[model samples]
Target: MTETIAPTPNTLPARSIAPWLKFTLELGPLLLFFFANSRPKLFAPLVHPFLPAKLLEGESAGLFTATAVLMVAVLVALIVSYAITRRLPIMPLVTAILVVIFGGLTFYFQDPSFIKMKPTILYACFGLALLGGLVFNKPLLPVVLDNTMSLTETGWRILTLRWGVCFLFLAVLNEVIWRTMSTDHWVLFKFPGTMILIFIFTFSQVPLIMKHELRGDAAAKAPEHL
Candidate 1:
């Protein structure tokens, strides 16, 4: 039998959202984006707030169906995430909530622009929240990643800053891609490609984090368990 070697000082699990689960969670938004972009009104009825219930009951069947599907998918993803993690994560939970709201708006207003602008909304929210955290001398990354890595407060600060910047970059990239590239390219990039990019970026920062590593309970538990 071959011995399997794990990554040295692997800060986190290789799988973030798991395989099939991740696909189910992320794929919904992509499909909604494409459908809405192509059909334009594919999600308008179920997306809006002030629209009468009969609005979906009367006109725009296609848009209603698409928005309904999108809502179900978002709910499923959120449920799965909460189930697995035993608590909601900051980013994905926020993503889910925004997807519902924006997706609803896209369907309700019969305007593709609202849904198209989803990335900008997400990016701006996270950017502001992170920057706010920094201003208060509080780094939120560790709270989300606390179970995964052992690092000092300064390490957390550095990591959060890098990620905050990366998220901002993603926001810009999303704008450029959606504006320039085909919808297919944007969706494909959003899924596995984004995950890979984040992994690589996070790994590159491992050394910097390790430099400020703390001997926490995860360290303390190692020998005791052994």
Candidate 2:
């Protein structure tokens, strides 16, 4: 599968997504993924009569099954996003591509490692992209976040640094978790646990954003000022 690089966050000029709708579009697939993994036996039978017997007769069949379902769910979510806004989001689109690739490998080879490694790949890509942008003195956080909130250059730099570091940290965390713990634990961490950490980190940044808040006409100020 070919992976498409997502547009910088908040950079896409398009219709606004309602907070609830955006959340549903993003998290729905993940929730389905967690359910499939956690209840593979239940899921296996549900899909059993439909799939060929040869595909579901192995020690790792449950995980393979879950991975397959997860792939479908991801595709569905992406389609829904496009139907709603008439535009495909960068991050989710990139993620769906990875899911198809790794998830396909998992189903084909009957190995769970490929699917397990998807998050690590995604996090590393995002983290490196942000940090690399900073190295070139081009803050790309605005690309992703410009529409959500306004921030001065300093604010963008700080937020970018934090998110960059966080993504890298999550990459390491995923590696450690999947390698050391059960799949169920990893699935839990994948959603709410990761969500909580991100929310907290984001919450901590409100003060910085406020401190650097641009007043009236500041955003429209001369390009040189920017």
Candidate that would win on TM-score: 2
lDDT of 1 at 16: 58
- Note the residue pairs that clash in candidate 2: 9-143, 9-144, 10-144
Instruction: Write model 1 residue lDDT over 1-226, tens digit each, in one string.
Output: 9998765643334335566876566666656644753454545544555455554443344444444555666778778776664556666777778878987787668664565567777886776667678888887776655345666667777877888888888788878877887555665566556667878997999789879776767555532100
Model 1 Cα shift for residue 106 (angstroms):
1.1
For model 2, how does the per-residue alpha-carbon lDDT over 1-226 read when each residue is reduced to its tens digit? 9997787755554566788988887888877777777677778877787556766765556566777787888899898887767677778888999999998787677678888899999999989988998998887777665345566888778888988999999999999999998877877888778888889988988888899877668866613311
Cα-based lDDT at residue 25, candidate 1: 66
Task: State the RMSD for candidate 1.
Answer: 10.0
Candidate 2 stretches with Cα past 4 Å from truth are 1-13, 49-59, 220-226
Models, CA RMSD each: 10.0, 7.3
